[model samples]
Target: MKKGIIYAVLAYLTWGFLPLYWRLFTAMPAWEILAQRITWSFVFVAVLVTVSRQWRRLKSVGSNRRSAAAIVLCSIFISLNWFLFIWAVNNNHVIETSLGYYMNPLISVLFAVVFLRERLSPGQWLSLFLAGLGVLIMAVQYGHIPWVAISLAVSFALYGLAKKIAKLDVLLGLAGETIVALPVALGYLFYIQSQGTGTFTSLPPFSIILLLLSGAATAMPLFWFAKSMQLLPLSFVGFFQYIAPTTSLLLAIFLFNEPFSEGNLISFSLIWLALIIYSFVTFKKSKVKVVPISRADAL
Candidate 1:
């Protein structure tokens, strides 16, 4: 349990601090950065697969068309999520990005009800109500939809659902997704270079190195997260999931100096309150005491 807690904390901390890492590539367009992330992450994971002699697992994925289709869909969703997040961080919307992650668990619940046909408890319904109210408040306050937050939450939730249904293990599943995305990423990089708009050509060595490091940044936390989920209870893992967005919120306020309007605060407060209620209810009611399952348990 202690080891699980430690691993989960480390994973969340890495994710929380990722904005700072991506901020290093602020000179590049978000698309280019995203492309590099996908490409290099593919390369990195491919190397890991080779080193671990997990080639058979990759081969096995090719035997199932349904799983391949699900993974392709998951890849699209995750790619969108990654691009939006990087854009948000670079474009001074880190707080909004944080809001999306803060709202993700609620969004997952909604997805479960809608697509999975799972019934929600009364407490879960109330939590969703509070979360909806928070979004409405934020929309009213901003005089527009909080699309960044909404998009992030929805895309990631959908990605999680796809992964859940596909039932692929973490490393192999991610490898499949990245491989599916690899061609598009490479093609984009190629086109950009041909157009002379690519950042890679003119970037400083340190910046180039940082871009390469995006692969490690993408993979390591996921590995830790998968390990932690294996070691811990789902409810406990769910509770620790808040650490990432909480850290992002702090970084947004103090480091990036983003304006936290009064309205934003109120909306966030409502969401946090809802999460508290949901977590408490879930912990209290969950009595199965089953071991955590290993197939993409969380996003």
Candidate 2:
């Protein structure tokens, strides 16, 4: 249990601070960064799998049709989530990104109901109600829609659903998703360099180093998270889920100095209140649980 708590803390800390890492490559387009990320993530995880002799499992990722289709969808959505997050962080929307992560668990509950034929308890429905009101407030604040938060939440939630269906080992699943997208990523990076629009080759040495290390940044927390999930009860881990977004919320207001308006304050209050209620009800209900995914929340 202690070890699990430690792992969970480390994983959430890493994810919480990931915005700083992604922000380092401000010169590169989000698309290029994502491509590089996918490419190097594949390289990094591929090495780990080979060294751990998990290559056999990696090969089995999409053997059957359903799993194959699911893996493809996983690749697409995770890629979208990654790009959106990186873009949002760099573009000064980190607070909105935080809001999205804050909103994700609730969003996943809705996803479960609609797509998985799952039912929600009254407490769950009440949590959703407050959350929806919060989002409605945010939408009004934005004067249209809070697309960044919604997009990130929905994309990550969809990724979680697909992941639940995939049901592969976490590392294997990541490897498969990266591999599925590897060709396009590689081609795009190659083309960008060829067209003289590439940022990688011309980046400063330190920046180049960080770019290479982004793969490690991207995948290692996931391993830590998987370890924690294995060691801890789901309910315990679920409480720890907000650490990443809460960190992001802080970083946005203090470190990055993003504006946090009154509307943001009110909406976030409602969302946080809802989460508290949902979590309280959830924890009180049972020890055996099926929980929604958190930030960096893989199945």
Candidate 3:
């Protein structure tokens, strides 16, 4: 339990600060940065697979068509989520990014009810309604839907759902997802390099080093998150999920100085109220388990 708590805190903290890291590549294109992230993440995880001798497990998973297909779905959603997040952060939509993550748990709940036949309490339903209302308000205020925020929320929620379906060893599963993405990532990177638009050639040596290190930066938090989930109930770990978005919201408002208008405030407040209800309900229903996670708790 202690280890799980520590891991969850670390993962959320790292994720919370990730906008700052992505901001370093603001001068670069989000596509190229995403390609770099995918490529390097694969490299990083491949090395881990080698060192930990998980190659057989990896092969075993690849041999299974259903798990392999699920991983491919994970790769697609996660890749989209990664690209959208980087683009949003670099393009000064940090607050929207924060909003997206803040709404993720609610979206996950909806998916559970819709796809998994899971039941929701009355409190949960009300929470979902409030969150939907908040989103509708945001759309009305913006004169269009906040697609960045919605896409980020939905993509990641789908990624989580796909992960639940994958149901393999965490590291091995991650390795498979990256490997599936590796080819397209490498292809796009080469295309950019050939077109002379690649940051790899034009950026400072320090930036290049940072770009190379982005792989490890991308993977480590995920490893921590997986480890934590393996040691804690989804409901308990889900409680910690708020840390990332809350930190991102603070950084967006105070550090980035994004315009937080009255409408934004109202929308966020409603969503927050919804989350409070949701969390209280979740906690009331949750038991404090001692680090014996089950397959049912995979996501």
In TM-score terms, which candidate is top? 3
Write the residue-wise lDDT of candidate 1 on 65-173 in tens digits.
9888988998899899999999999999888888787767666666666776766579867876886687677667656777998899889778767765676777888
Q: lDDT (CA) for every model shown?
A: 0.80, 0.80, 0.82
Any residue pairs clashing in model 2, and if so which? none
Residue 73, candidate 1: alpha-carbon lDDT = 97
Rank candidates by lDDT, best first: 3, 1, 2
Residue range 1-299, candidate 2, lDDT tens digits:
66887887898788889998888888899999999999889999999888889987666656778777888998899899999999999899888888787667666666667776765668867877897788678667777667888898888778767766566677887788889999999999899888999888889999988888888988888667666656654434544656788889889899999888899789878878877887777656654555777878673
Runs of candidate 3 with Cα error greater than 4 angstroms are 1-6, 228-240, 288-299
Q: Model 2, 98: alpha-carbon shift in Å?
A: 2.0
Question: What is the C-alpha local distance difference test score of candidate 3?
Answer: 0.82
Model 1 TM-score relative to the real fold: 0.85
- Residue 282 in model 2: lDDT: 63
Backbone clashes in model 1, listed as residue pairs: none
Clash-forming residue pairs, model 3: none
Candidate 2's error at 268, in angstroms? 2.0
Query: What is the per-residue lDDT of model 3 for residues 252-286, given as tens digits with 9 covering 90 to 100?
Result: 99999987778878887887887789878765765
